[model samples]
Target: MAGELNGKIAAVTGGASGIGLASVESMLSAGAQVVIVDRDAIALKAICDRYGDAAIPLVIDLLDPVDCATLIPKILELCGQLDILHCNAGSYVGGDLIENDTSAIDRMMNLNVNVVMKNVHDVLPHMIERGSGDIIVTSSLAAHFPTPWEPVYASSKWAINCFVQTVRRQVFKHGIRVGSISPGPVITALLSDWPPEKLQEARDSGSLLETSEVAEVVMFMLTRPRGMTIRDVVMMPTNFDL
Candidate 1:
């Protein structure tokens, strides 16, 4: 499995930590030159330093429209050609929708939804020209289920789920494979939004997934034969309930 990604170049958003960081390590181990894209300048620098040139760091606020528009362009500028793109950066807003402010809701939608679309749109041209590329968006299990607690967050992911499938239909003929990974309750900072008791219960019950576990799924999706597109992978802990 090692060196499976040799000669490939990848760009992962939110690559400084959590699922993104773990995926970065997985891709690097498989022999891909990964560009760690995140807004955290310090963390990005640290990660790049650890991996040397194999890990290129790009620090920019994705929430900013100007920065978001320029993400793929910048990655292409740095890597020449982007063989893979992992849209893993996202924000969480759990609990009743009424309890959150409009600003929080807006921010979540912009990053979790808008920015993802923009990045995909921007990268499509390059991929189409080359006639080959892989795109993986990080969706959530909430997108498939109607969970009332986090309506807003779930809605954002649902939008992404739709987007991924629809885009796949349109782009497959171009030799571009598009898909999403819908993971349930991974142990990341995103869990901070869950109720304390619920989080503790999941941890105690072995129902929470690790970031690396999710990253391994990303690796699997990437390494599949080009003719076979894994449309969506929904992974969860064996003990996970609802």
Candidate 2:
């Protein structure tokens, strides 16, 4: 499995930390040259340095529609051929809906939903031209369940679920594979928004998933044969309850 992705090129958004970082590491170990995309230049530089030539850093704030539009083209320019694109950059907004400001909601939705869609849209023409490619969007378990505590965040992922499915249908004929990985409560900065008591409870119950665990699922989705597309993978900690 170490060289399963040898000769492939991958671009992962939010690759500076957390799930994105873990996925980048996984891809590198599999022998793929990965482009690490993130807004933090320092983190990008550090990661790229640690991984040497296999990890390429691209720093851009994906929240800017103008910048997000440039992502695919930039990756194409850098890698020549982008075999995989993991839209893992996202933001979290938890707590009662009324407690969140409109600006925060807009930011979360833009990063979680809009950016994923835009990146996928921009990459399609290239992948379709090649007649083969893999696209994986990082979704969340909230997308499939009604979460009152984080209604806005859940709504954003729900939109992602629909988007991934629809695009998968449209691109299957082009030899492109589209899918999403939905994991629950991964231990990342995203959990900082959770109520302190709830966070503690999840910790006590061993209901938190590590970033590496989710990255393994991402790898699983990416490595499957071209003939079979994994539509979506929903994973959560065994102790995690809705």
Candidate 3:
């Protein structure tokens, strides 16, 4: 029997590890062929090893708009048609906004918003033709709440959530569904910068949402029929985060 997502094609960014990697696994398990894009060599290869032909791994730096533009066409060529895009690649490279270096702020803006907009612009034409496709982005809770210690990161995420909301309004008329997943801290390689003591404390708080939990939100959006759309989903850890 064919899987629920049999014959579908998905492209995911920051897909080599963390929430991105988890989404890759989730999509594949649902029977969709996937193309994984990330800057990491080792993790990308591991993804390919397990899924083999069903998964294609590409090394990409999202901050580079050229990669975003180029990858858009490459995805269509590989899949013959594109059905879904999961723009889940992002990083936390900021301190407080006032003392933050200008370069770091620029990088965060480019990676978090500019690159994603470029990719969306490039892929939207084809998706428009079909008038049916899935677009899922991973935002953050900091998008809505305050992050005094990481103002730039907070601003970046808030902007991302705004982008998703605005795009949802623009695309829904065309039958293209757009949604974002806002996940509270979950264990992942992306959190490597946190000191061990701080990390343990967060985990012990008993409210961390696992990668699978976030994946379920993505699944819900995709599995929804044409009759409905999920604009944004904010997932909280039961213990600490609201």
Winner by lDDT: 1
List candidate 1 segments past 4 Å from native. none
Tens digit per residue, CA lDDT, model 1, 1-242: 69999999999999999999999999999999999999999999999989999999998799999988889889888889999999999999888777899999999999999999999999999999999999999999998998898899999999999999999999999999999999998999998867799999999999999999999999999999899999999998989864
If scored against the real structure, what TM-score would every candidate get?
A: 0.98, 0.97, 0.94
Model 3 steric clash pairs: 207-239
The alpha-carbon deviation from the true structure for residue 184 of candidate 3, after best TM-score superposition, in angstroms, is 1.1
List lDDT for all candidates, in order. Answer: 0.94, 0.93, 0.84
Candidate 3 lDDT by residue in tens digits, 1-242: 13868889999999987888888888899999999988888988987998889999877777766666688888877778889999988878655567777897788788888877777777888999998898998888888788777788888899888888898889888889988888877787757777898788888877667888888788888988887998888888877644
Model 2: residues with Cα > 4 Å off, grouped in runs: none
Clash counts per candidate, in order, are 0, 0, 1
- Model 2: lDDT of residue 199: 92
Task: Order the candidates by TM-score, highest first.
Answer: 1, 2, 3
Candidate 3 regions with alpha-carbon error over 4 angstroms = none
Q: Cα deviation in Å at residue 95, candidate 3? A: 3.5
TM-score of 3: 0.94
- Which scores better on lDDT, 2 or 3? 2
- Candidate 2 C-alpha lDDT tens digits along 1-242: 59999999999999999999999999999999999999999999999889999999999999988888889899889989999999999998888888899999999999999899889989999999999999999999999999988899999999999999999999999999999999998999888867799999999999999999998988888888889899999999999875
> On TM-score, who's better, 1 or 2?
1
